[model samples]
Target: MLLALDLLGIFVFAISGGLVAVRNQLDIVGVVVLAMATGLGGGVIRDVLIGAVPPPALDDWRYLAVPAGAGLVTFLWHPAVERLERVMNVFDAAGLGMFCVAGALKAHDYGLGPAPAAALGMLTGIGGGVIRDLLAGRVPVVLRSGELYAIPALAGAAVAATGVELGVRPAVVVVPGAVLASGWRLLAFRKGWTAPAPRVSPPR
Candidate 1:
Protein backbone atom coordinates (compact mmCIF):
# COMPACT_ATOMS: atom_id res chain seq x y z
CA MET A 1 0.00 0.00 0.00
CA LEU A 2 2.76 2.42 0.92
CA LEU A 3 4.56 1.69 -2.32
CA ALA A 4 1.36 2.24 -4.24
CA LEU A 5 0.78 5.48 -2.43
CA ASP A 6 4.29 6.60 -3.32
CA LEU A 7 3.70 5.91 -6.99
CA LEU A 8 0.33 7.62 -6.98
CA GLY A 9 1.79 10.63 -5.25
CA ILE A 10 4.55 10.68 -7.83
CA PHE A 11 1.99 10.64 -10.60
CA VAL A 12 0.09 13.51 -9.03
CA PHE A 13 3.17 15.61 -8.55
CA ALA A 14 4.36 14.75 -12.03
CA ILE A 15 1.12 16.03 -13.51
CA SER A 16 1.49 19.26 -11.63
CA GLY A 17 5.03 19.59 -12.89
CA GLY A 18 3.91 19.04 -16.45
CA LEU A 19 1.22 21.65 -16.01
CA VAL A 20 3.85 24.10 -14.91
CA ALA A 21 5.89 23.26 -17.95
CA VAL A 22 2.90 23.85 -20.17
CA ARG A 23 2.34 27.20 -18.55
CA ASN A 24 5.98 28.02 -19.24
CA GLN A 25 5.83 26.95 -22.87
CA LEU A 26 8.55 24.42 -22.32
CA ASP A 27 9.42 21.77 -24.87
CA ILE A 28 8.72 18.07 -24.41
CA VAL A 29 12.19 17.38 -23.05
CA GLY A 30 11.93 20.22 -20.56
CA VAL A 31 8.53 19.05 -19.46
CA VAL A 32 9.78 15.55 -18.84
CA VAL A 33 12.81 16.75 -16.93
CA LEU A 34 10.82 19.02 -14.69
CA ALA A 35 8.12 16.46 -14.06
CA MET A 36 10.60 13.79 -13.10
CA ALA A 37 12.52 16.18 -10.91
CA THR A 38 9.45 17.45 -9.14
CA GLY A 39 8.13 13.97 -8.58
CA LEU A 40 11.29 12.34 -7.29
CA GLY A 41 13.42 15.14 -5.89
CA GLY A 42 11.80 15.20 -2.48
CA GLY A 43 11.76 11.46 -2.10
CA VAL A 44 15.39 11.33 -3.06
CA ILE A 45 16.21 13.95 -0.49
CA ARG A 46 14.20 12.18 2.17
CA ASP A 47 15.95 8.91 1.50
CA VAL A 48 19.34 10.55 1.59
CA LEU A 49 18.56 12.22 4.90
CA ILE A 50 17.45 8.94 6.41
CA GLY A 51 20.32 7.05 4.81
CA ALA A 52 18.16 4.93 2.55
CA VAL A 53 21.25 4.09 0.50
CA PRO A 54 20.78 4.65 -3.22
CA PRO A 55 17.26 6.12 -2.78
CA PRO A 56 14.10 4.58 -4.16
CA ALA A 57 14.02 6.70 -7.27
CA LEU A 58 17.40 5.36 -8.27
CA ASP A 59 16.84 1.79 -7.15
CA ASP A 60 13.44 1.44 -8.78
CA TRP A 61 13.38 2.63 -12.35
CA ARG A 62 9.59 2.87 -12.21
CA TYR A 63 10.02 5.91 -10.04
CA LEU A 64 11.69 7.49 -13.06
CA ALA A 65 9.23 6.03 -15.53
CA VAL A 66 6.12 7.31 -13.80
CA PRO A 67 6.94 11.01 -14.10
CA ALA A 68 8.27 10.62 -17.59
CA GLY A 69 5.02 8.91 -18.51
CA ALA A 70 3.01 11.68 -16.91
CA GLY A 71 4.87 14.28 -18.92
CA LEU A 72 4.25 12.33 -22.07
CA VAL A 73 0.58 12.05 -21.26
CA THR A 74 0.34 15.77 -20.63
CA PHE A 75 2.15 16.57 -23.85
CA LEU A 76 -0.01 14.31 -25.95
CA TRP A 77 -3.26 15.68 -24.56
CA HIS A 78 -3.22 19.43 -24.72
CA PRO A 79 -6.96 19.65 -24.27
CA ALA A 80 -6.78 17.49 -21.21
CA VAL A 81 -3.91 19.59 -19.97
CA GLU A 82 -6.05 22.67 -20.48
CA ARG A 83 -8.75 21.05 -18.43
CA LEU A 84 -6.43 20.41 -15.51
CA GLU A 85 -6.84 23.72 -13.73
CA ARG A 86 -10.17 22.54 -12.41
CA VAL A 87 -8.60 19.53 -10.73
CA MET A 88 -4.99 20.60 -10.23
CA ASN A 89 -5.49 21.70 -6.67
CA VAL A 90 -6.85 18.31 -5.74
CA PHE A 91 -3.78 16.57 -7.08
CA ASP A 92 -1.41 19.02 -5.42
CA ALA A 93 -3.13 18.58 -2.09
CA ALA A 94 -2.95 14.83 -2.27
CA GLY A 95 0.76 14.89 -3.08
CA LEU A 96 1.48 17.26 -0.25
CA GLY A 97 -0.41 15.23 2.33
CA MET A 98 1.05 11.90 1.34
CA PHE A 99 4.64 13.09 1.12
CA CYS A 100 4.53 14.98 4.41
CA VAL A 101 3.14 12.13 6.45
CA ALA A 102 5.44 9.62 4.85
CA GLY A 103 8.48 11.78 5.39
CA ALA A 104 7.71 12.35 9.07
CA LEU A 105 7.06 8.70 9.77
CA LYS A 106 10.16 7.62 7.92
CA ALA A 107 12.21 10.03 9.92
CA HIS A 108 10.78 8.83 13.23
CA ASP A 109 11.33 5.26 12.25
CA TYR A 110 14.94 6.12 11.53
CA GLY A 111 15.40 7.22 15.15
CA LEU A 112 14.97 10.92 14.71
CA GLY A 113 13.22 12.99 17.36
CA PRO A 114 9.88 14.70 16.87
CA ALA A 115 11.23 18.11 15.86
CA PRO A 116 13.57 16.81 13.20
CA ALA A 117 11.01 14.33 12.01
CA ALA A 118 8.42 17.06 11.70
CA ALA A 119 10.85 19.23 9.83
CA LEU A 120 11.61 16.35 7.50
CA GLY A 121 7.90 15.99 6.90
CA MET A 122 7.64 19.59 5.86
CA LEU A 123 10.64 19.18 3.61
CA THR A 124 9.18 16.09 2.03
CA GLY A 125 5.94 17.90 1.31
CA ILE A 126 7.38 21.14 -0.03
CA GLY A 127 10.87 20.24 -1.17
CA GLY A 128 9.80 19.26 -4.63
CA GLY A 129 7.76 22.43 -4.99
CA VAL A 130 10.75 24.46 -3.96
CA ILE A 131 12.93 22.78 -6.57
CA ARG A 132 10.26 23.20 -9.21
CA ASP A 133 9.85 26.89 -8.49
CA LEU A 134 13.55 27.43 -8.48
CA LEU A 135 14.14 25.59 -11.71
CA ALA A 136 11.19 27.42 -13.26
CA GLY A 137 12.48 30.73 -11.93
CA ARG A 138 9.26 31.43 -10.07
CA VAL A 139 9.01 32.37 -6.43
CA PRO A 140 8.28 29.30 -4.37
CA VAL A 141 4.72 29.10 -3.09
CA VAL A 142 5.81 28.15 0.43
CA LEU A 143 8.53 30.77 0.60
CA ARG A 144 7.15 33.85 -1.08
CA SER A 145 3.53 33.99 0.06
CA GLY A 146 0.69 31.63 0.77
CA GLU A 147 -1.94 30.91 3.35
CA LEU A 148 -0.85 27.87 5.36
CA TYR A 149 0.98 25.70 2.90
CA ALA A 150 3.76 24.54 5.19
CA ILE A 151 1.57 24.83 8.23
CA PRO A 152 -0.70 22.01 7.15
CA ALA A 153 2.30 19.80 6.50
CA LEU A 154 3.54 20.55 9.97
CA ALA A 155 0.15 19.75 11.41
CA GLY A 156 0.06 16.48 9.55
CA ALA A 157 3.44 15.58 11.00
CA ALA A 158 2.28 16.32 14.50
CA VAL A 159 -0.80 14.23 14.00
CA ALA A 160 1.39 11.36 12.84
CA ALA A 161 3.50 11.69 15.94
CA THR A 162 0.46 11.72 18.14
CA GLY A 163 -0.81 8.62 16.45
CA VAL A 164 2.49 6.90 17.07
CA GLU A 165 2.31 7.86 20.73
CA LEU A 166 -1.22 6.52 20.94
CA GLY A 167 -0.20 3.22 19.33
CA VAL A 168 -2.48 3.63 16.35
CA ARG A 169 -1.30 1.88 13.25
CA PRO A 170 0.09 4.16 10.55
CA ALA A 171 -2.57 3.06 8.12
CA VAL A 172 -5.25 4.04 10.58
CA VAL A 173 -3.86 7.36 11.80
CA VAL A 174 -1.24 8.88 9.53
CA VAL A 175 -3.11 8.17 6.34
CA PRO A 176 -6.33 9.78 7.53
CA GLY A 177 -4.50 12.74 8.96
CA ALA A 178 -2.77 13.28 5.64
CA VAL A 179 -6.03 13.04 3.75
CA LEU A 180 -7.61 15.50 6.15
CA ALA A 181 -4.78 17.96 5.67
CA SER A 182 -5.04 17.64 1.92
CA GLY A 183 -8.80 18.19 1.99
CA TRP A 184 -8.48 21.16 4.28
CA ARG A 185 -5.77 22.63 2.08
CA LEU A 186 -7.92 22.27 -0.99
CA LEU A 187 -10.87 23.93 0.73
CA ALA A 188 -8.63 26.69 1.98
CA PHE A 189 -7.29 27.30 -1.49
CA ARG A 190 -10.70 27.39 -3.11
CA LYS A 191 -12.06 29.67 -0.37
CA GLY A 192 -8.96 31.85 -0.09
CA TRP A 193 -8.74 31.05 3.59
CA THR A 194 -5.27 31.38 5.11
CA ALA A 195 -3.35 32.05 8.23
CA PRO A 196 -3.04 35.77 8.97
CA ALA A 197 -0.18 37.36 7.09
CA PRO A 198 2.42 38.87 9.26
CA ARG A 199 1.36 42.31 10.40
CA VAL A 200 3.60 45.12 9.33
CA SER A 201 2.81 48.36 11.09
CA PRO A 202 2.81 51.51 9.05
CA PRO A 203 6.29 52.87 8.77
CA ARG A 204 6.94 55.65 11.25
Candidate 2:
Protein backbone atom coordinates (compact mmCIF):
# COMPACT_ATOMS: atom_id res chain seq x y z
CA MET A 1 0.00 0.00 0.00
CA LEU A 2 2.81 2.40 0.91
CA LEU A 3 4.71 1.64 -2.26
CA ALA A 4 1.57 2.08 -4.30
CA LEU A 5 0.93 5.51 -2.84
CA ASP A 6 4.52 6.56 -3.45
CA LEU A 7 4.36 5.53 -7.08
CA LEU A 8 1.08 7.36 -7.63
CA GLY A 9 2.56 10.52 -6.17
CA ILE A 10 5.60 10.16 -8.41
CA PHE A 11 3.50 9.88 -11.52
CA VAL A 12 1.48 12.97 -10.70
CA PHE A 13 4.50 15.07 -9.77
CA ALA A 14 6.38 13.90 -12.86
CA ILE A 15 3.57 15.06 -15.09
CA SER A 16 3.62 18.42 -13.34
CA GLY A 17 7.35 18.76 -13.96
CA GLY A 18 6.95 17.71 -17.57
CA LEU A 19 4.29 20.37 -18.06
CA VAL A 20 6.65 22.98 -16.67
CA ALA A 21 9.31 21.85 -19.05
CA VAL A 22 6.94 22.10 -21.99
CA ARG A 23 5.84 25.55 -20.92
CA ASN A 24 9.46 26.62 -20.85
CA GLN A 25 9.95 25.28 -24.41
CA LEU A 26 12.36 22.61 -23.27
CA ASP A 27 13.28 19.64 -25.43
CA ILE A 28 12.50 15.99 -24.76
CA VAL A 29 15.62 15.47 -22.71
CA GLY A 30 14.84 18.41 -20.50
CA VAL A 31 11.28 17.23 -20.01
CA VAL A 32 12.40 13.76 -19.00
CA VAL A 33 15.07 15.10 -16.66
CA LEU A 34 12.67 17.41 -14.90
CA ALA A 35 10.07 14.69 -14.61
CA MET A 36 12.47 12.22 -13.06
CA ALA A 37 13.90 14.80 -10.70
CA THR A 38 10.55 16.06 -9.55
CA GLY A 39 9.14 12.57 -9.06
CA LEU A 40 12.08 11.10 -7.16
CA GLY A 41 13.91 13.97 -5.56
CA GLY A 42 11.79 14.28 -2.46
CA GLY A 43 11.80 10.60 -1.59
CA VAL A 44 15.49 10.42 -2.18
CA ILE A 45 16.04 13.31 0.20
CA ARG A 46 13.86 11.77 2.85
CA ASP A 47 15.56 8.41 2.54
CA VAL A 48 18.98 9.91 2.87
CA LEU A 49 17.95 11.97 5.86
CA ILE A 50 16.66 8.90 7.65
CA GLY A 51 19.74 6.82 6.70
CA ALA A 52 17.71 4.70 4.31
CA VAL A 53 20.60 4.92 1.94
CA PRO A 54 20.39 3.97 -1.75
CA PRO A 55 16.82 5.28 -1.71
CA PRO A 56 14.23 2.97 -3.22
CA ALA A 57 13.77 5.49 -5.99
CA LEU A 58 17.38 4.92 -7.02
CA ASP A 59 17.34 1.18 -6.40
CA ASP A 60 14.00 0.24 -7.88
CA TRP A 61 13.32 0.04 -11.59
CA ARG A 62 9.57 0.56 -11.11
CA TYR A 63 10.19 3.98 -9.61
CA LEU A 64 12.35 5.01 -12.54
CA ALA A 65 9.91 3.68 -15.10
CA VAL A 66 6.84 5.42 -13.72
CA PRO A 67 8.29 8.91 -13.91
CA ALA A 68 9.94 8.29 -17.26
CA GLY A 69 6.66 7.10 -18.69
CA ALA A 70 4.82 10.10 -17.30
CA GLY A 71 7.41 12.42 -18.86
CA LEU A 72 7.06 10.79 -22.28
CA VAL A 73 3.30 10.91 -22.12
CA THR A 74 3.36 14.59 -21.22
CA PHE A 75 5.90 15.33 -23.90
CA LEU A 76 3.78 13.67 -26.55
CA TRP A 77 0.37 14.97 -25.51
CA HIS A 78 1.14 18.18 -23.69
CA PRO A 79 -1.69 20.12 -25.30
CA ALA A 80 -4.24 17.64 -24.04
CA VAL A 81 -2.57 17.50 -20.65
CA GLU A 82 -2.33 21.27 -20.41
CA ARG A 83 -6.01 21.54 -21.24
CA LEU A 84 -6.70 19.70 -18.02
CA GLU A 85 -4.69 22.01 -15.82
CA ARG A 86 -7.45 22.47 -13.27
CA VAL A 87 -8.04 18.77 -13.01
CA MET A 88 -4.33 18.17 -12.68
CA ASN A 89 -4.23 20.59 -9.77
CA VAL A 90 -6.74 18.40 -8.02
CA PHE A 91 -4.54 15.36 -8.53
CA ASP A 92 -1.51 17.30 -7.38
CA ALA A 93 -3.26 18.05 -4.10
CA ALA A 94 -3.92 14.35 -3.64
CA GLY A 95 -0.32 13.53 -4.41
CA LEU A 96 0.84 16.03 -1.84
CA GLY A 97 -1.40 14.55 0.80
CA MET A 98 -0.24 11.01 0.18
CA PHE A 99 3.41 11.93 -0.06
CA CYS A 100 3.43 13.74 3.27
CA VAL A 101 1.62 10.99 5.11
CA ALA A 102 3.84 8.36 3.57
CA GLY A 103 6.95 10.26 4.48
CA ALA A 104 5.89 10.70 8.08
CA LEU A 105 5.04 7.04 8.38
CA LYS A 106 8.36 5.97 6.93
CA ALA A 107 10.25 8.21 9.28
CA HIS A 108 8.33 6.88 12.25
CA ASP A 109 9.09 3.33 11.15
CA TYR A 110 12.73 4.32 11.18
CA GLY A 111 12.42 5.38 14.83
CA LEU A 112 12.40 9.11 14.42
CA GLY A 113 10.59 11.32 16.89
CA PRO A 114 7.21 12.74 15.96
CA ALA A 115 8.41 16.27 15.37
CA PRO A 116 11.24 15.33 13.05
CA ALA A 117 9.10 12.79 11.27
CA ALA A 118 6.45 15.37 10.59
CA ALA A 119 9.01 17.87 9.34
CA LEU A 120 10.51 15.30 7.02
CA GLY A 121 7.07 14.45 5.77
CA MET A 122 6.40 18.03 4.83
CA LEU A 123 9.74 18.16 3.08
CA THR A 124 8.96 15.00 1.20
CA GLY A 125 5.81 16.62 -0.14
CA ILE A 126 7.33 19.94 -1.23
CA GLY A 127 10.96 19.13 -1.98
CA GLY A 128 10.32 17.78 -5.44
CA GLY A 129 8.32 20.81 -6.50
CA VAL A 130 11.08 23.08 -5.25
CA ILE A 131 13.64 21.21 -7.30
CA ARG A 132 11.43 21.34 -10.38
CA ASP A 133 10.96 25.09 -10.11
CA LEU A 134 14.66 25.71 -9.55
CA LEU A 135 15.61 23.61 -12.53
CA ALA A 136 13.04 25.44 -14.60
CA GLY A 137 14.64 28.78 -13.56
CA ARG A 138 11.72 30.05 -11.56
CA VAL A 139 10.95 30.67 -7.91
CA PRO A 140 9.22 27.71 -6.35
CA VAL A 141 5.49 28.28 -6.23
CA VAL A 142 5.34 27.15 -2.59
CA LEU A 143 7.75 29.89 -1.68
CA ARG A 144 6.52 32.70 -3.88
CA SER A 145 2.89 32.07 -4.73
CA GLY A 146 1.70 31.78 -1.11
CA GLU A 147 -0.53 28.92 -2.10
CA LEU A 148 -1.66 26.74 0.81
CA TYR A 149 0.64 23.94 -0.36
CA ALA A 150 3.31 23.29 2.26
CA ILE A 151 1.10 24.09 5.23
CA PRO A 152 -1.34 21.37 4.32
CA ALA A 153 1.53 19.00 3.78
CA LEU A 154 2.84 19.80 7.24
CA ALA A 155 -0.62 19.43 8.71
CA GLY A 156 -1.07 16.04 7.14
CA ALA A 157 2.35 14.93 8.24
CA ALA A 158 1.68 16.12 11.75
CA VAL A 159 -1.55 14.16 11.83
CA ALA A 160 0.16 10.98 10.66
CA ALA A 161 3.00 11.39 13.07
CA THR A 162 0.61 12.03 15.92
CA GLY A 163 -1.41 8.99 15.04
CA VAL A 164 1.61 6.75 14.95
CA GLU A 165 2.91 8.14 18.20
CA LEU A 166 -0.38 7.18 19.78
CA GLY A 167 0.16 3.58 18.57
CA VAL A 168 -2.36 3.66 15.77
CA ARG A 169 -2.07 1.28 12.83
CA PRO A 170 -0.55 2.91 9.81
CA ALA A 171 -3.22 1.66 7.46
CA VAL A 172 -5.95 3.25 9.52
CA VAL A 173 -4.01 6.47 9.98
CA VAL A 174 -3.41 7.03 6.27
CA VAL A 175 -6.94 7.99 5.27
CA PRO A 176 -7.72 10.89 7.57
CA GLY A 177 -4.30 12.47 7.20
CA ALA A 178 -4.45 12.26 3.44
CA VAL A 179 -8.04 13.46 3.34
CA LEU A 180 -7.33 16.43 5.57
CA ALA A 181 -4.42 17.60 3.45
CA SER A 182 -6.02 16.98 0.06
CA GLY A 183 -9.40 18.27 1.10
CA TRP A 184 -7.93 21.42 2.55
CA ARG A 185 -5.82 21.96 -0.55
CA LEU A 186 -8.83 21.54 -2.85
CA LEU A 187 -10.86 23.92 -0.74
CA ALA A 188 -8.07 26.49 -0.75
CA PHE A 189 -7.91 26.30 -4.52
CA ARG A 190 -11.63 26.70 -4.94
CA LYS A 191 -11.82 29.52 -2.40
CA GLY A 192 -8.66 31.39 -3.41
CA TRP A 193 -7.17 30.95 0.06
CA THR A 194 -3.49 31.71 0.32
CA ALA A 195 -0.74 31.78 2.91
CA PRO A 196 -0.19 35.04 4.70
CA ALA A 197 2.38 37.23 2.99
CA PRO A 198 4.56 39.86 4.54
CA ARG A 199 3.24 43.35 4.31
CA VAL A 200 5.85 45.64 2.81
CA SER A 201 5.68 49.25 3.78
CA PRO A 202 5.34 51.67 0.88
CA PRO A 203 8.55 53.48 0.08
CA ARG A 204 8.62 57.11 1.29
Using lDDT as the measure, which candidate wins? Answer: 2
lDDT of 1 by residue, 1-204 (tens): 778878988988887777788788899997888888889878778889899879868888889899899889887885677687677778778878988898888887888877888888888888887787778879986885767788888788778866765677777767776976787788788898878777899999
lDDT of each: 0.81, 0.93
Which 10-residue window in model 2 sums to the lowest lDDT? Answer: 1-10
Q: Residue 28 lDDT in model 2?
A: 99
lDDT for predicted candidate 2 compared with the true structure: 0.93
lDDT of 2 by residue, 1-204 (tens): 767877888999999999999999999999999999899888889999999989888788999999999999999999999888888888899999999999999999999999999999999999999999999999998898988999999999999999999999998899999999999999999999999999999999
| Candidate 2 ranges beyond 4 A from true positions | none
Q: Least accurate stretch of 10 residues (summed lDDT) in model 1? A: 161-170
Model 1 residue 91 CA deviation in Å: 2.6
TM-score of each: 0.89, 0.96
